[model samples]
Target: MSDINNWVLPEGIEELLPDEALRLEKIRRDLIDLFASWGYQFVIPPLIEFLDSLLAGTNSELALQTFKLTDQISGKTLGIRADMTPQIARMAAHHIKKCDAPVRLSYLGTVLHARGAQIEKSRSPIQLGAELYGSQHIKSDVEIIQLMLEVLAVSAIQHVHLDLGHVGVYRGLAQQAGLTTSQEGELLDVLQRKSSDEVVELLETYKLDKKWVNVFVQLLQLNGDVTVLEQAKKVLKLGDASVQQAIEELQEIAALLQQSYPSLPLYFDLAELRCYRYQTGVVFAAFVPGFGSEIARGGRYDNLMIEQGEQVRSATGFSADLKVLTRLMAVILDEQAKEIILAPDVLDENLQGLIRELRTAGKTVIMQLPDSSKQPNHTALIAKVNDKWSVS
Candidate 1:
């Protein structure tokens, strides 16, 4: 209604100034190149799609975050993407020709969320990620995690703390205990919050055998260093074969990561069910010392393709907010130091040639207008010296 209101952007939405924009672009290009080196082909999915396709294979959390509208042309409900992972899955399943080998794809773009996460309050974030499809092996999971760490390294972020979990662990336990879907969902909620009293109360209400009760309780304390995995194997021995298999998969991946990144901090959390409804297997998130929440996260969603009505395929990937990465980058870009050449208003052919040469050599050149009173800030100036036009 007012001029001020017109300039005010929605909460959690932001615009980048010149310096920040330039730095973000540089980081984006560098990371894209990094993904390319790893044999990941880049993809550019649309910002909006039909609601059903956009929301396919994702959880209710994503659905709540998506902003919906009616498309006048098609008179169909459309949804702006709140997360690109599902779209990436769709592309891999339908667009790309089916191949036996895994399809590696990377994407970078802005995603709109109706509401922001509590820790990071940005509704509009530039999401950058890579996905490996068609492989169910632990090696693929490890590769995705390794690539996530490399992304942090490229952004100059250090001291990353990685938290790993397997949804299969809990899935197996619930199935073995014969808990109903509602009961499992309730338990998952309490476990994620580490609400000990509530967790105990719910398990007591379930009236399970002591072994089932004990294993469920132990899940809360199963978070710590790598040693927690050994404890999990022993405590969860009562679980079915699927439980043991999940633990073994985690162990194998942890061993590989420790061998490759010896100094990386790894924490095991059996109760960490991030993206639980969407993820089918191993889940992981990366955090730094000061950051209160994960800077990047992803997990295995082996059933996503099948749920989308396509052939079965395994998928794993991680996504980070490019805006956050730019903010946390250790190297500060000094845009002011960039050379800017100012050429005087002139009609001489030689002056034009020199301007062209400077521009061709990657210099920013500003030609002076005939009668303009405005003067731009420039780091250098083009002047005639000894009958020759030169930059000083």
Candidate 2:
């Protein structure tokens, strides 16, 4: 006898039923249209690639989350993509190199992770995102942020709270303090946890100057509303020039976002170092009231393409799990499932023609089969009236 566990799926993997799949498809089409309206051409990268190319310039976190296997043909290690950013970066560098102007690209595909994120438990997520390449101006960053917010709005996800940060803040301080790579990593680990005690202990253990230690500790508290920017300007005034520049960049981006979305709840976190290993500049993520983790995130990675053996080009974008967005939308939006029509299984050319006509008119027509006891849920049915095919 076959084992009962044969049908069970791996943990964190999932399949969507008919209703959920329909909803997800509809949202996918709508989002792709939205991106197109913004001049973002859609692209589909491969699900797997050479491990080195797939993980190029990405942090160890991504490498840890990737599943690796040997390619029988080439005898080389290949990785199932855990993220699409690196893949897209390579595409921009190698494939779309002829054009010098900024390129806007969007993609929707499934990404498999070896381990799930802290709050999101799914290891297989349908990732949907847009990337803008070849520009590093503050306007480019603001545009990406605006587009991200627009994406959430289109998905009917409400009450979005955006948290903004710049890794340069911490990087600048780490450099000014002359902290070694190992020491910087240790400090970063504690800063991410917001453990002020550990941060002080580590700093004292390193014997850093009081000025650097004070600023480093102050980084942990530089969070909250817009006023935090003013505090940051004064507190980081004595640090590296890049620290001051990062603060200014954040200020400018915030002002633009406020102008475009005056009622948006925006927060700042100086100590936030998301994807710090590759992100060169500003970083941001969106959240909702009950969600314990960010729903979507992206940041500038000016050096990623260079690491791919191509010329340096600035890039920034945002991504979210399409499945998660669809789930959240289901809760917020009223049910408006499409109408499905049932038809008789009789072998009649006229009936077949009518079914075709109905389907052409955007109606879902499911023909019944002979000797079948299965019943389908349909909103309407096709019937014979006056010797003609009609929907009743």
Compared with the true structure, what per-residue lDDT tens digits does model 1 show for residues 273-296?
967888999999999887778889
lDDT of 1: 0.90
The count of backbone overlaps in candidate 1 is 0
Alpha carbon lDDT of each predicted model: 0.90, 0.88
TM-score of structure candidate 1: 0.95
Per-candidate TM vs. native?
Answer: 0.95, 0.95
TM-score of 2: 0.95
Point out the worst 10-residue segment of candidate 2 by lDDT. Answer: 329-338
- Maximum-TM-score candidate: 1
